[model samples]
Target: MSTIDPTGVTLVIGATGTTGSRTVAQLTAAGRPVRAASRRAGPLPGAEPVRFDWYDPAGFDAAVTGADRVYLVPPVGDPDPAAVMLPFLDRARAAGVRRAVLLSSSAIAEGGPAVGRVHRALPGLFDEWAVLRPSWFMQNFTGTHAHADSIRADGAVLTAAGAGRVGFVDADDIAAVAVRALTDDRAPNADLVLTGPQALSHDDIAAILTDVTGRPVVHHHLTYEAQRDRLAAVIPPEFAAMLAGMDRDIAGGSEDRTTDTVRRLTGRPPHGFRAVAERELGAPAASAAAVHPESPTGAGSGGRLR
Candidate 1:
């Protein structure tokens, strides 16, 4: 397998976020130089913090400067992020950035939606490029996302997905694939559809959470319009509609498939939902009885795509 030069630095956008943070950590742990970009530019172990904001282009040049490769995470909650993202990407390309790896959703496709437009433009901007179309992140239910908030407050997971199943993937696995795509001697040069080992319904997720946390978590189904309205309360109405439509599509079996992309790329099996729960939620080893004494969980509620 051909490899890219490991001497160049990598700029990680959204460095404080779920996948971005992990990507930065992994890159740095591998003895690679990383410029971690975020609004606050907060400190991360083994990374150089750089202040960056998509809406503000003043810092864009500095963020891309000295970096040869970049990991892209579009600004969250913006209905049309391409408007701002495209300009910065052009700047990065001109500033000597060569490789780019974008974090996109499995529900979206090239030229399909928000980040999809970016996915379509990536190849034209950089000769070395990859788009990581990862399934809904398992971090959504563990981090500060709406699903996790509701679970902590009311012990319920809300969604319009009904009984449909999704191949929920862990954010760590997404980051692992991203690191490979960025640093590998060869750029993926293609969109990678990432998913965990198996498909799981929301009920299975709730049961896993209930067992792990010992808090009796449950899935609370809602109508499409209701889900949209609920999400609109916090995010833009258009973005909220888009998110609810994903749920509607889920109910139609759109996200029911799984992929071996993670294992194929990372050289190991992806983590299961139960395993993610046990690790992220601090579940004891005894709580592994939730899934027939065997298995192992991403998104089920209103949250920004990260």
Candidate 2:
């Protein structure tokens, strides 16, 4: 395999997902060539959407073909992601993809428990790589989740994080920083911890939502056990346990700190939770009321480290 040119095509692994989609949009808007890799190869304006799946190793080469750089996001629900990601990174390197930007979680830094292993192993696999360790996504309250729907209905949020503050980030900002890393030679072989400008507790986030939507939104805290029970009813027990464990970590003051990585990389301070709330919750009853017709309960919101 020949060394990939820096100006060659950039492939986004999870093009349909929140961050990936925004990355695609930003890259395309900037007139950079992009190949969007997902399960489906559909018509995405200004991009060549291709089919790729992490579970199917046969499809990996096709996805990485002729790409210079790749944005790698592990598939959700994989208990051991490094087992899949490490080998895939090897293949991409072998296929001449020189630079890679990996979207890792802030909770899984070098010393952290589960996801740290991947964080530690990534830089060794490629000549140039960047690990994006971002905090909770602001999309949890706007996207397809019980929280978003509940917020639309009852104007309330629920979480197990009693008063633990989180530096929630906009997925768009994460994507923007990702595009810069993938395209610019300045970002290389670094681990960036990106966060919002300020740390805000769930209660603070609720207040912001109320102010943005002109509705009575409140934060309802629950015990870890109660949160686990609520999540287990919808997702698998193991996944629920993983989520509950994260919350336990948060409650223990694991993710309450703030960082300046976003400003360092993007030349702008990270957006605050109130700003995100305004954009997502500004429309008031029109968007929120369309969420659920059957359920009368308000939406639930909380910080989940992504």
Candidate 3:
């Protein structure tokens, strides 16, 4: 791990998402100079917010101007982001950015699957680079999945992974580690697989919710085909297929391990699922449960390559 000077500005791409927003907040709170890049231009507290779009390569150079480090996150819908990201990394390198920290997934390692192709190609693009391989996020329970609605209405959670467990990490933990990689010189160059301290299946999560909220919550296990059919009614066919494929992987025991990388990088154990649910959901869990009906449940597992 090369220790580049940490004084120069760090640019944050995808500065509005769950992890990106938190990264920006943490970096700025630590008194580090930061430049937040997004498609929209606005004033972000404690950082310089600029207009940038991954679809428009013309905006790339300007976004990284005067920055020493960059946090690279790909756009959400690009089936193959490496094609778009490689050229941008080339630009950042030419523009004199010293280090880059990529937000990657545990599912897609250096040639594992769809997004893995991009992961495989990342190391060769920068002198100092670190890939964050994190498992499913704990946010889906309270933020953006149908599970949130299920928790709100029927007091249940749903998944296709019958007994598969996941070491679901908090997005905040991922962001904290990203901030360290962006600013500190001690982070490793190789892929970092981060996970929560413990692995919990959907049933375990449902039990936690039941305990914390004082409501009867249950985990509804569905077949991959059934889950796919349920999601197909609301999402695009391709996206639904991708989701179903992940469920298949989980059911097959692909994501049933834990890692200490979170603690190694950030000097703290990754937050537990219940802690995250409570922090994000808050007391009077009923009021929190009432907020979102369709909260996502199985994020943190990045989408698979088709």
Q: Rate the local accuracy (lDDT) of all candidates.
A: 0.86, 0.76, 0.77
Q: What is the per-residue lDDT of model 3 for residues 1-306, given as tens digits with 9 covering 90 to 100?
A: 554666789999988777888899999999999899988956789999989998899899889889888988777645577778888888888888878888877766687654576677767777777888888777666664446655665787767888888888888998998998888866467788878889888889888877776667899898988878877776666666677777777878888999988888888888998888777665774445444434334332223211
Judge candidate 2 at residue 112 and give its lDDT: 49
Q: Please rank every candidate by lDDT, starting with the best.
A: 1, 3, 2
Per-residue lDDT of model 2, residues 221-306, tens digit only: 88888888887776667767777777777777878988888777778887777777666656656445534435453323233423
Question: Largest TM-score belongs to which candidate?
Answer: 1
Which window of 10 residues has the lowest lDDT sum in candidate 2?
A: 297-306
Clashing pairs in 1: 3-185, 4-185, 137-298, 273-297, 274-296
Using TM-score, rank the candidates from best to worst.
Answer: 1, 2, 3
Better of 1 and 2 by TM-score: 1
Which wins on TM-score, candidate 1 or candidate 3? 1
- Quote the positional error of residue 113 for candidate 2 in Å: 5.0
